[model samples]
Target: MAATVEAVIAALRVTLEEAQKSREASWKVEAVNRWIGQLPGSWSGRWRRLVLKSDASGNARRDELVAHVRAVIAFLETNRQQIAQSRKWWPLRRRWPANSPIANAPVAAPASSSARPVNLLRVRKPMPGIH
Candidate 1:
């Protein structure tokens, strides 16, 4: 279960968006480090060595690091097609399911898979929470 191009891209995008939305340095660092751990093959090791954040006194410093990484992500977006078809990625691919269990979880079947439609909208309860 190696990491597909879609998984990598999605993970990177989600991490960036979440970190951008949060003002806390610790939150940003944790999000980024988690992403780095999920990176495919050597990428994980490489990013782990990089400086995401240190005992910084303020959020500004940590945010700047994440901002700089966004440029690299933008480049990745532009070259997505190329990266998807690259043979190099085959060996470097990571196990996507290992990092995202929710995505791979079994979808529960309907309790009444054979039954017809249940018109819940028409048979509404006498308004919930009413005495």
Candidate 2:
């Protein structure tokens, strides 16, 4: 009877250890899921690549996952100002059509009398057949 009790206790200890490991793994997966979900749209592709690399690494430590999230957050924060400025100016700096009047015209004088006139003519390229 004592031997049976000892065996049962040993089995219970193994079961508890396995349960704890399962719980920890579940928590880590949930944390990674939350981090991925919260990642910015612009950063999703990078995050996906990180996840693939991490999976290939086979070292799914919680700290490593958190480190990746923090790194991405830091990168986005550091570049946020530049990214915003570029987005703000991108549309305004669009390429002008070659045939537009503004493209063909010389610079006009500003309306204010004190403003100096500027020359800004487009240089024409010689035709291939005529050259």
Candidate 3:
């Protein structure tokens, strides 16, 4: 039960971090607000009182702020992988690359430091003028 709880928390943290990065990188204010809006009141309230108050949107501290955010995201990702593996989620563990589809069984192991580039080319084109 503890493992499950931790896994759920890790998953949510990853989701929130990705949402935040998408918003910051793309100027998606509505998306950012929506992500916050979906959170439980207590979580957001606590974060606002703690991190947000300390993290005034001042340009002089921009680098420090961004670094802190990135650190949090890194921590989240690490724990998420740990919790998933502890639960024997093969798709998350025993895989050469973290995001690759799980093989039927462990075949060949790849170095953890090796980075694989993801190809994002999709087959279908968007309906005209959608973006």
Candidate 4:
């Protein structure tokens, strides 16, 4: 009976542990990124199979686009640490660079929150809109 009670207590304590909170935060960010990453794959598949025209009023389209841009900027700021700045968004466990000295060895967690996740996008015509 005592052993059982102790086991239950330990299980309950796991949620309150620092490691658990860190893992939860890390997982939340990773899961979100994984979902975002899937869009390109699915979009390309759909794009190849569909021939569709999109049209909308300048104001309506402008409003929608502006809203999306704001949301994206907020999300990026909030999740900057969780993102793999180099596009490496490796499973946080596999976040290390292969050529790095420690990369050959297994890393239990990331090096540091400040070290990763910078969202950079490039386009041939950039400056007018890069910001």
> What local distance difference test score does each model get?
0.57, 0.45, 0.42, 0.36
Per-residue accuracy of model 4 over 1-131 as CA lDDT, tens digit each = 23332332343244224333342222222222222333223234421221111244212232333333344435434544544232322234655677888767765885567575655653354477667
Point out the higher-scoring one by TM-score: 2 or 4.
2
Model 1, 1-131: lDDT tens per residue?
13554565577678777667767655445555455445444344433343255456423354665674585467556866765565543455664756598767889886866777879888867767995
Runs of candidate 4 with Cα error greater than 4 angstroms are 1-60, 85-131
For residues 21-86, what per-residue lDDT tens digits would candidate 3 score against the true structure? 543432222322332333223144522321322323322233444454455445435655553444
Kindly report which residue pairs in candidate 4 clash with one another: 83-117, 85-117, 85-118
**Cα error, candidate 1, residue 91 (Å):** 5.1
Best by lDDT: 1
Give the TM-score of each candidate.
0.43, 0.31, 0.25, 0.24
Whole-model lDDT, candidate 1?
0.57
Sort by lDDT, best first.
1, 2, 3, 4
Best by TM-score: 1
- The 10 consecutive residues of candidate 2 with the worst lDDT sum are 1-10
RMSD of candidates 1 onward, in order? 13.7, 20.0, 18.7, 22.8
On a 0 to 1 TM-score scale, where does candidate 2 land against the true structure? Answer: 0.31
Give the TM-score (vs. native) of candidate 4: 0.24
Evaluated against the true structure, the overall lDDT of model 4 is: 0.36
